[model samples]
Target: MKNLQPIISVESDAKMSKCRTLIMLISPTLVLAIIPIFLSFIIKKLILMTFLIFFGFSSLAMSASDIYFFIVILLKMRNNELFYQEDNKIYILKK
Candidate 1:
């Protein structure tokens, strides 16, 4: 039988793990936030610009809150058993 488990590395150092997590969280948020600003520049319509600016700001706000909640969850889970979900199954990490 093929092993149908997700492999998660739990041996990474704390600093590196934090760095990786931040990058993952920030990169997409930055891209989404910046795209609207850039589009507003290329688009000369005032209405479009206003809409884009609003969208950009709202996305930034939502992303910030999402990142905050994600960090909170991580902190809360730090001492708990880590689990990974794949194909509707949850696998607990063995420390």
Candidate 2:
């Protein structure tokens, strides 16, 4: 069978590189902007813990919010998309 797939040319490769560079640059800025919201949640948790401590309830169990945040961080650390090139076509798989 003759292969009929189009090869990725240099210009498209350059464009992809530029797109990746732009994403890399913008991701950190977005993270920075979101930090304060995460910090506020942590601060709120600390205050709740302090109140519990003062009331002599010393059991410090993980809250649902804490687990949610942890999962979110884990998800963020992993790539959201898987790119596969098959039969000369690009496929993006999202988690």
Candidate 3:
């Protein structure tokens, strides 16, 4: 059987690479922030810990939003691959 992978264009591949690069850039800071967050919890600093947890979660949410977009693009590519071609047009099975 033939492979059913999406035919990714270079432009979109580059954009995904850019998104991955941004994630790589942010990950280190997020990792570093974890130590302080943990320390605040251990020291029983409720106010500081609460604030840090919120801040950390907000940054994580930003990364998650980026990932969500990336996943949507990947799903679109997969859907494109799943279609059949006819008369130079494309379609999928139904029924």
Candidate 4:
């Protein structure tokens, strides 16, 4: 008699890992916050340092969980990555 069994394999590529790392860093809130700062610098010549200080302080005031998520989104966006859902599975794609 011969034994028959199912073989399962997992393959992770650097590209996928990078995408995940990016997604973990850039959260939605961070993107929204950053947009205003960008506009302020573009339209009013406000100093970036000042905007950064204010952004940091405001983010710090949020709950730990919210802050974490916000940072995750920001990092992802900075890296030109985004997350999508398909068939209930989450996927990170590069832009």
C-alpha lDDT of all candidate models, in order: 0.61, 0.40, 0.49, 0.52
Error of 2 at 3 (Å): 51
Which of 2 and 3 is the better model by lDDT?
3
Which candidate, 1 or 4, would have the higher TM-score against the true structure? 1
Give, for candidate 2, the lowest lDDT window spanning 10 residues: 56-65
User: After superposition, which runs of candidate 4 have C-alpha atoms over 4 Å from their true positions?
Assistant: 1-18, 45-95
Segments of candidate 2 deviating more than 4 angstroms: 1-19, 45-95
Question: What are the runs in model 3 whose C-alpha is more than 4 Å off?
Answer: 1-37, 66-95
Model 3, global lDDT: 0.49
**Top of the candidates by lDDT:** 1
What is the RMSD of candidate 3? Answer: 13.4
Residue-by-residue lDDT tens digits, candidate 1, 1-95: 57543343223323323334546556656787879978988999999999998998887876775478457646654443444445544344434
lDDT string, candidate 2, 1-95, tens digits: 57743342222322223234335434433343344344444665777645544433221121233334345444543355543335456454555
lDDT score of residue 87 within candidate 4: 43
Q: After superposition, how far is residue 55 of candidate 4 from its true place, in Å?
A: 8.4
Estimated TM-score per prediction?
0.45, 0.23, 0.35, 0.27
Cα lDDT tens digits, model 4, 1-95, are 45432243223343334446444445434564655555555655457657765775565444355456556655554456655544425577776
